[model samples]
Target chain A: MIEVAGLKKSFGDVVALRTVSFKAEDARVTGLLGHNGAGKSTSLRILYGLIQPDTGFAKIDGVNVSQDRILAQSKLGVLPDGQGLYQRLTPREHMRYFGRLHGMTEDMIEQRSQELIGMLDMGSIADRRTGGFSQGERMKVCLARALVHNPKHIVLDEPTNGLDVMTTRKVREMIQELKTLGLCVLFSSHLMYEVSKLCDEIIIMAEGRVAAQGTPEQILATAEESSLEDAFVTLSERVAQI
Target chain B: MNILRTIVAKELLDGVRDRRSLFSAFLFPFLAPLFIYGLMTLVIQQNTETESITLPVINADAAPALVAHLKEAGFIIEAFEGDPEAEVAAKTVELVLSIPIDYQKTMAAFETTRVTIIHDGSRNDTSATVRQVRNLVRIYSSELNALRLVSRGVSPKLMRGLQTENGDIASDEQRAANFLSFVPIYVLMAAFVCGLGLAIDQTAGERERRSLEPLLINPVSRLSIVFGKCLAASIVAALGMLITLGMCLGAMLMLPIDELGIRFSLKAQQVVGLIMAILPIPLLASSLQLLLGLFAKSFKDAQSYVGFLVFIPVVPTLVMNFLPFATSFWMYFVPVFGQSIMMKEILGAEPVPLLAYPAAALPTLLAGLLVCWLTSRLLDQERVIQS
Candidate 1:
């Protein structure tokens, strides 16, 4: 479970997040939907303990991030905004490195690495260096490494942003599997259809604030729109007017 | 500690696989020794060449006795008819001996005569040969004076009012060590050059690749991460320093330094002393590199900054070389300067005070730690990741 409350952050004179609050519970895929520059990444970064909010707090499993960042971070698996991999490292090495950082023993690292490679269908390219990997292949490696420690809560920032059709479906399926395993998965994206299909609950952000948030049925009823896409457009426009 | 170890292991593996880092680390160690060999060979060749001089004499026929004297002194005489000044000015000959046409007349009249040696005073390459010829002429003149004094039934000793001799105190080893004094500077430079690529790659290169964010997102302390990176860079740098030291020892062993009229040999203790003097420098160098690298916005920017930072070791070396100062105890507290002085002492076979070793290393290690601490603080700043 990940919880962010009254998060307010600013970069110089420009505010990045203003009064943003949301909760992503265990056993659910919670989607943070916003347009570019709508503060989704900033909110997620705050939740992952990478950024500190000026006001309010983020907590992982009720452990306050600001008060105990390391303990909070240990419980969270992060596929950050830019999933940068060491080009000279193989997929298995990547998994092993992150696993070690999480203080996993060698045997556990090896076991978890094999399990991730199998689940991600990355066995063919598991031992090869990531230097020449395709975009989809790199994404798989990033996801596998993030999941290596098997944290209770997972945060992915636009995980399917640049993936092709088949890789996109694979990622959606993986998220579904994580949800079924009773882990809290919070992801941020600007894609309406992906969010509508994958998320058990949706949080719409506009101008650094939460514009609307609920289950799909509740969100549609609140916006008085038939489709979720139209509801998001209408709700964001109302927030912009206000 | 385990996190630090893990970070160190990962960085080392990453650095070893980077061809650019490996190339930078190994290139200078191999080349510095070859440079020493080439330089020492050139000095030996120049010193040996001075023993046999080729003399270009204008009007050689006018001074048969003088020419014969020069021949007995092992001067290969070549008669030249061209203008002596122009020949020397053009560098066609090192120097010219002009025997005046009235040279025999003055000698027959028992009067002092002049033999002008035409040469460029500013040219150092031919100064030794010119000095040799001048000495030979002075000896011949004194001999002639002695014979004249003997014919007059007076002792030639009466003509010598005072005799002077030189007492040089420097040992042959010391002289040879002075010739290779730049060895210490080369070794120090290796400390800086070897880890440059890796240091920049791990810090600035990490930022440019956008990997720092993800790495920091892990539950590792910033200090552990920074220290780990610094240790990895220092390891490569230490390897470079060792290779350079080994190659220098090999070069000293292989070169015919004795041919240059000096004995040059490094004892096992002195080699050990050299290693002790330089061991702490790589930590200082890599930590400094990491600090500066974190400030740079990109890999190329870090490279340019590091290129400028290499001058840190060189500035003290140049200052010490050109404007020598009296050695004081406090000098050891300064990093490169102190190490350089210690290296000089070891190379010269002079006894170094045992305290001097830690005096040099402690400050360097402390400075390294300080820089690493500052780098960790920089890592905590949000701008470091945002940029």
Candidate 2:
């Protein structure tokens, strides 16, 4: 379980997040919905211990990671929004590197990397440097890396970003499979269809605060809309206007 | 065998894949040194050929026989009037060589006559003219000594001071070793320049290419990435230094030393001594350069920043060879300081005590490690990754 409480942060005078609070329960995919500048990525980043919040606490399995990050980040996996993997390293090499950092033995890394390679269908490119990989391939390689150490909690920011329609559908199906495996999934995205297709629960963020949270169908029914996009629009009027 | 191994392998693979970098890191090592040192040697050879200049002699006494003797010695001597100062400043004259008017009186009394040399130090031909004047003075002194010895009825051969002609009896090995004095300086310079290029291309080039973000997102600690790149740069630097050494020795031997007129001879063993003397300087220079390059946010920044390392060796090198310095144990540990001293020792200028080797090598290697470790820690900070 991951909990973010009162996540107030600022960059100079611009408030990036304000009193943000949410929880990602086990065995469910929680979709963080937001447009540009909606603080979705910021929230994910803060939870991943990449940046310290001015006044907030991000906990992973009841351990406050912002205070003692090394413990918190160890149990979590994050695929950052824009940042790609080191281009020089091959996928196999990347997996091994992360495995070692996460305290896995050389044999364990080799085994885990093999499993991930098979599951991800990236065996062919595993030995090749990631420098020349296509965007979708790179994204998948990042995904394989996230699972390399077999962390309990996964936090992905815009996992399907810059991906083609076919790749997006595959990624959505993968997320569903992850949920079935009882993994706690915390993913952020602006695409309504993608979020509605994969996430079990939706947490729509507007500006710096949580505007709504519930099952996609329930939220849509309450908002008197037939689609998740209309429901998001109904709840995020102020942010949409701004 | 480990994740660090994977990272290092990946770094090496990437280094090889980047063609521009491959050219700079590997090829430039051989080409750049040959070009630079070769060009330098050529320039020196051109400038050092014997020079000819006109000598102006001012004889206030108007001594005809002395002027005739000077003319016979191939000096383009010209007569000047007034006190030597007036003719010293005259145009079309390089120098004022004044023989005192009382030269005959002083010579009869067995007294030495003063010959004052005067010229504007800032003049274009001042150095050349001064050297010619000194040569003329020597010839004149030799003639006078010969004349004085004959008048005293002493054997002219006695003035040769027992003819005790001393030539350096050092073996070919020692002479070749002595020539190695420049090896440390050259290797350090080449290595620093090579590392500068490698570091900039690895660090700032990655950032510019927008490949840095993906690398930072990895679960691996940032230290792994920094060290990976640092090690790669060090390897490239090592390659360049080795190539320079190899090529220089090859050029020294294969390129016809007799043809080049460089009496300097360096064999394989002498090359090994140069390698030993220079081994530590590269670690010191390259590590510092990498640390500096990491701070650069752009390739140009890294390029200019690393450029400073290349020139740094100049001071230590020129100082060791051209300036007055005494070798001590402490000096060996002072980065280029130790290497330069050891190099001088290789050159048969063994003022450097052999006991100072440990004091010099250990501290320098340790200091380099300390700096490299600090750079690793600084890079591990997440803020640097995002930046």
Candidate 3:
């Protein structure tokens, strides 16, 4: 499980996050929803220990991220905001690299690689270099490597931001599968439809603050809107008024 | 330790597969030797050219005796009737020797007559040949005076003066060592050039590709990651330095250095000494490259920064070449300068101080570590990751 409380961060004069809080429980999919420049990536970055929050705490399985990043990172599987891969490395090599970084033995890395390749249906391209991989193929490689260590908490930032329909569906299915495996899966996205479809809990952010947090039904009831998209618009407008 | 090894292995594999990185690593080792060979061959050719001069002579009939004397002196004489001035001015020949029309009459009367050597004063290539011809003429003039004095019953010894003897202390090996001084510089250059691409690619290229954030997310210490990359680059650079040294030795062996009146050969111990002197440079070079690469905003920016960094090795060489300073004990503490001076001394068969190796290498290795440490500190910054 991942828990963040009272997270505040700023870059120079611009505040990236302000008094934001959320909890992503195991066996559930939680989505941080926001528009562009709405601080979704910044909040996730702090949670992943990439940046320090000014005044807040992010815990991965009860280990404070800021106090002990290595321990916190060991429990976290992250497909970060920038999911770049080595062009010359094959998918299996990528898996081995990350798996080794996570302190796995060669045998364990091999076993995990095989399982991920099979699960992602990436067997055909497992040995090929990723230099000219299509967007879907690249995403799969990134996702496979992220899951190589099989951490209890998985965080993906905009996992399907620019993917085609088929690749996007593949990513959505992977998130659901992780949720069913009793893992705490947290993702951030600007797509309302994807959030409403995949998330069991939603945290709506506006202007670096959490505007609302609840289940889809509770969010709709609170915002007095029929669709989650209209509810997000209403909640953001309410924050703007404040 | 295992994490460091994994990072190193991954970086090495990535570097090996990059055509650009491999090209950068191996290109200088091959080209530097070929360049040294070409340069040494040109030097030897120029030296030999001066030994056998072809002199174009005008009015040869008026000075047959002098022509005979020159031919005996090993000057290849070619009789000519054209304008001596024009021939030399056009560089059709190196120089022209014009015997004046009154040469025989003046010689019979024992009067001094000028034999004009028409040549371009600004041309340095023919200067040695001109001096040889003038000396031969002076010898012939003095010989004629000696014979005249003997015939007149005047002792030729009366004209003798104090004789000056030349004392040249430089040995043939010492002279040859001067020609081989560039060998050390080339080997040092290999250290800087070979690992440059990989160093930049691993640091700044990672950032530009946006792979750094993902890589950093893995459960590894920043020091381990930076050290691993630095070690990987240093390994390539060290290999390059060794190949360049071997190639330089081979090229030196193939050159006809003995024909240039110099004895040039490398002792087994001296080659080992040269290797030891330059071995630390790769570590220094890659660490500096990695440090500068971290500050760059992109891969191309890092390349520009690294391009300027290559001049570090060359600055000391150029200073030693142009504004040479006396070798001091403290020079052994400087990195490239120390390696350069040591390599030259080894090639020249001079005994290096026992402490010089550690004195030179330890500081370089330490500085590399310091740079790697600073890079690790930089890695912790959010700006570096996001930039």
Candidate 4:
């Protein structure tokens, strides 16, 4: 389980996140929603220990993300935007490299890579350099990089942004699969339908603050609407009024 | 350790693959010497042209024998119609030889009659030609004195002066070879140039690509991470210098045998001394470059910042020319200054004092490490890395 309290972060005078707090509980998909400047990515980045919060902390299984980030991060996998790959590395080489970073031996990395390749259907391109891959292909390779070590949580920011419908389905299926394995998955996205379909719980952020947090049905009911689309419209309208 | 190996492997693979490093590390060193050397050779050949000395004169010597001998020694005999002063302004001749009116009369009494030779000092070759002509005139006049003494029945051997030729043993080839101060300035340059691409790519390239975050998230010490990258950069730079040295030695050895009379290539000991002197320059340069590149935002930013990198190697070379710093064994341990002095030593000059090499080099290496530590601190700062 994860817990966050009073997280604050800023870039110079412009605050990216202010007094924000949320958690991705064990075995649940927590969708973080926001408009362009909503701090979802910043919050997720902080939670993944890729950054520090100016005034608070997030913990996974009681281990502080800020203080023991590597330990906290070792318990989770992160696929940051741009699908960070070394470009020159083949899929197997890339997987082996990240595995080594987390302190896995060559044998262990090799063992884990085989399993991931089979599961992700990435066997065909395992030996090909990631530089030549399409956007969707690179994303799967990145996902494979994160999953090779099999962390208990996964923090993916806009993981399906430029994917085809089939690949998008493939990625959402992977997230569902992680959730089934009792992994705490925090999904940050800008699309309302993407959140409504995949998330058990959603947190909407606006102007460096947490605007709302609840399940899809509950957030819809709070907007006094039936469907997620109309509910998002109502919630945004209310946010504008504020 | 595994992280370092992995990172180093990645760096090497990337470095070798980069077209920029390939050019700077392997290609540039070869072409640099050819262009500079070829250009210098062309200039020297054009400047040192040989031609006969032209002597414009009004001979006042009563002995016509002296005049005949002088003309035979390759001096173009131009008999002036009037005063030497009038000949200069009209530009009738390039030089004027003004022999005293009673030259032979004074010579009979063993009193030397001086000749005033005039030529345009602004013309570079004129002075050399004038000096050559003066020597010929003296020698020819000396020959007449010997003949006059022989005719008068005085001992000819007594008038014959002692003759000696002072010559050094070093061949023209050896002198030319030794002329190159072996200024391992190239070594220092090799270090910086080789490290340039690696340093820029490791820090600024990561920032530009937006991939620094993922690496930063790894639960490793920031110092460890920086050390790993710095280690790779240092190695890359050192390798570049070695490649440069190889090309330089190759070029020296391949110099046409007939063109250069002596072995222009460095001796094994000289090569060792050279390598020893410049060995640390790359380490120091790469460490500093990495630190500087980290402050930049992009490859272009890193490259522009490197405009200042030129100062690192140049300042020492420039400084030493004015302030004569004695080379000590302790000095070779300092960065650029040590390397520069060591090169000055290997120029077939005196060997560097033993203790002074390390005394100079240790502090420089320490300073390099200190700068690298500062860069590590910058890596920890979010603001610095983000930009």
Candidate 5:
């Protein structure tokens, strides 16, 4: 489980996050829906212990990230926004390296890597260098590397952005599989339909604050709109008026 | 420690597979020794080849005996009718020997015969030739005087009052050291440049690729990452320095410097001593490079910064090698300068002063650690990652 409370962050004179709070329970997929510059990336970054928040606290499985980042990070697998792959390294090497960083033994790394490769259907390109991989292949490698050590919680920023329809379906399938396995998965995206399709709970952010948080039907009920898209637009317009 | 080791292993694997980094680290260091050896060979060849000495003798008939003696001494006597001064000024002839019309009259009167040897003073190649001709004339004049004294039934020994003998106190090794003065400068430069590619690749290159953020999100400490990357770069730097030192030693031993009457040989002990003295330098170089890379916003910026940093070590080498000031113990406290001075001592086979090695090493080690600490702090800063 992952918990964030009263997250507040600012850079210079611009405030990025203000009074943002949410909870992502295990065995569920929580999607953070926000437009550009809505502080989705910043909140996720703070939760992953990559950056510190001015006034907030994030906990991964009851361990506070700010107080003990190493211990907190050990329980979380983060795929940062626009993460780069080492061109000279293969998918297998990438998995092994992250596994070692997570303190996995050689045998465990090998066994877990083989399992992930099979599950992700990446056995064909497992040994090939990632220099010229397709976008879908690269995404699979990134997701597999993040999941190599089998952390209890997974955080991904813009996981399906800029992917083809086929690759997006593959990623959605993988997220569903994680949900079935009882892993708390938190992902951020701007796609309304993708969020409506995959997210068990949706948190809509506007102007660095949580505009609404609920299931799809609850969000529609709160906005008094018939479609999820109309509900998001109506909610965003309300935040804009403020 | 375990995390540091794992990071280092990954870095080494990445570096070894990078052709650009491997090329700069392994292949560039050999150029220094090859360049120095090539120049040395050219100089030796130029010094060994003999050229015949030629001179234009003006008014040749005035002093037949002197001219005959000059001819007997293997001088290629040429006859020139023009003014000797103009001929030398025009560079038509390298030298001119002008004997006055009354040369034999002065010689027969038992007086000193004045002979003028004219050559351009600005020409270095002519200096040796002028000295040769001057010595020949002096010897002939002295012989004639001795004959006259013996013919008059007087001993020639009575005319001599003071005898001067010349002695050279410079040892052969000292001369050889002078010949090989550029070695220390090249070795230090090698230490700085060999690890440059790896350092920038591991730090700035990783940032440019966008891999640093995800890697940092793992549970590893910032210090471990810094230490591992610095260690990997230093290994490459130190190995390049050692290879350069070896190539220099090999060139010195393989060349015919011994045939030039100079004692030039590198002992096994000297090689070991040099390695010991130079081992700490790569750590210092690698840290400086890493620090610069961390501060730089892009890989190209880091590369240009590192390119300019290489001259830092060379500046002290130039001052120490060329200046005439006495080397005090405090010189060993300076970073690159100290290493350079110590290398000179090791090459000359001099007995190094006590505490000099540690004094040279401790400052660099401390500076390296300080920069490494600063790098770790930078890793924690938001500016480095955001940039």
Candidate 6:
């Protein structure tokens, strides 16, 4: 499980995260819904200890992220906003590299990489260099790279931002598969259909603050709206008024 | 240790596969020595070629004997039908030799005679010709004086009691040192230039490609990452300098340095010694480049800073070359400066002091370690990450 409470971060005079709080439980998919600059990325970066928050704390599997970063990070899989892939390296190399950084042995790395390659349906391009790969193929490599150590918690930032429809469906399926395996999966997105279809709970954010958090049906009922889209707009405009 | 190994292996493989980095790491080192060799050959060729001197003779009929003597001494005498001074001023003639009309009468009467040699003093090659003509005339006058002394039954030794001869101490090897003085500068510059591409690519290039964030997100200490990258850069730099050293040695062997009357050759042992002497320099170069590259905002910015940073190692060499200072034992403490002086001493066949070796190498190794530590610290800063 991933838990964040009172997370606040500011850059100079601008606050990127303001009193943000949320919880993603095990065996469920929780979607962080926000528009651009709504602090979804910032919140995730803080959770992984890439950036420190001015106030509040984050924990992964009961380990405090800021105090014990290495231990907390070891128990979590993170796909940062940037798809940082070495173009000259193949999927297997990327997996081995990340696995080693996570302190896994060689045999463990190889076996985990093979399992990931098979699970992600990446056998066709597993050994191919990633220089000119399609968006879907690149996403698979990144996903496999993140899951190489099989962490209990997985965090993704806009995983299907620019993917095609088929590729987006593949990513949704992967998220469903992770959920079925009883892993806590937290991801950020602005796509309503994906959020409604995949997330058991939703955290809707507006202007660096969490405006509402609950199941899709609960968010709609609280906002007195018919669809998740209306509920998001209503909550966002209500926070903007405040 | 595992993290470091993985990073180093990846950096080495990535650097080798990058064609642009490969060119900087492997190809540019050879170009420097080959370029210097070509320039050296051209200079030596132009200096050694022999050419006959030309002098326009005025009133040739009045001094046939002197004219014959000048011709025999390898002066191509041109008969002047016009004013010789005007011909020289017009740049048509390099030199003019004028003999007075009473030249024979003056010789018979044993009177002092005046001869004129007019030549352009501004031309570099004209000085040799002027000196040659002056010497020939002086020799002729001395012979006449000796003959007159013989005719008078008075020994010429009475007029010239003391004789002085010069014995110069310069050997061919010592003279060759002058031509090969810039070897250390080129080799040191090669050390810096070889690692430039890899250092910039691994540091600023990683940031520009958005890979550093992901890499840093892994559960590894920042020191391991920086050290791994620096070690890979140092290895690439060291290998490049080794190749450059070999190529420089080959260039030295191929050039006919003997034509310059210099018995110059670099033996295998000396080459090995030189390599050992410069062992710490590549590490220093790579670490410095890594620090500067990481500080800069982008790859282009890092490359620009590195371009300026190269002058740091070269400044000492330039100062030493242009304004030669007396080298002392204390010079071995300065990084590039020490290496430059040591290499010159080694190549010039001068004995290297036993203590000078470590003095030249230790400081740079320590500086490399310090800079690498500083880079790792910088990696944790929020500004560097955001930038």
Candidate 3 lDDT score relative to the true structure: 0.90
What is each candidate's DockQ, to 2 decimals? Answer: 0.75, 0.27, 0.79, 0.41, 0.71, 0.63
Candidate 4 residue lDDT tens string, A65-112: 888877888887888876666776689987887788888888999999
| Model 3: per-residue Cα lDDT at residue B167 | 81
Q: Write the per-residue lDDT of candidate 3 for residues B281-360, one digit (tens) a residue.
A: 99889999999899888788899999887778777767878996777879989988899888877877777997999999
Docking class of 2: acceptable
Report the Cα lDDT for candidate 5. Answer: 0.88
Ranking by TM-score: 1, 3, 5, 6, 4, 2
Q: Which residue segments of model 2 deviate by more than 4 Å?
A: A66-71, A83-118, A121-132, A217-242, B1-3, B36-182, B208-221, B249-277, B319-323, B349-351, B373-383
| Cα RMSD, each candidate | 2.5, 7.0, 2.7, 6.3, 4.3, 4.3
Question: For residues B1-387, what per-residue lDDT tens digits would candidate 1 score against the true structure?
Answer: 888889889999999899876985798999889987998787777777743578999899989988999999889999978888988999998899999889889888988899999999999888888888999999998999999999999999998899988787878887877787777878888899999989998999888877888898898888888999999899989999899988987898788888877887778899889899999999999999999899887788889999887777777768877897878999999988899889888887878899999999999999999999999999867787775
Candidate 2 per-residue C-alpha lDDT over B331-385 given as tens digits, one digit per residue, 9 for 90 to 100: 7667677776676565553345556656677777777777778776655444444
Candidate no. 5 TM-score: 0.86
- TM-scores, chain A, per candidate: 0.98, 0.95, 0.98, 0.95, 0.98, 0.98
Can you give the TM-score per candidate against the true fold? 0.93, 0.73, 0.93, 0.79, 0.86, 0.85
Model 4 shows how many backbone clashes? 21
Q: What root-mean-square deviation over C-alphas does model 1 reach?
A: 2.5
Which pairs in model 5 have colliding backbones?
none
* Local distance difference test, each candidate: 0.90, 0.72, 0.90, 0.74, 0.88, 0.86
Residue pairs in clash, model 3: none
TM-score of chain B of 6: 0.79
lDDT of 6 at B33: 87
lDDT of 2 at B379: 58
Pairs that collide in candidate 2 are A84-B214, A85-B214, A85-B215, A86-B215, B178-B347, B332-B338, B332-B360, B333-B360
What CAPRI class is candidate 5?
medium
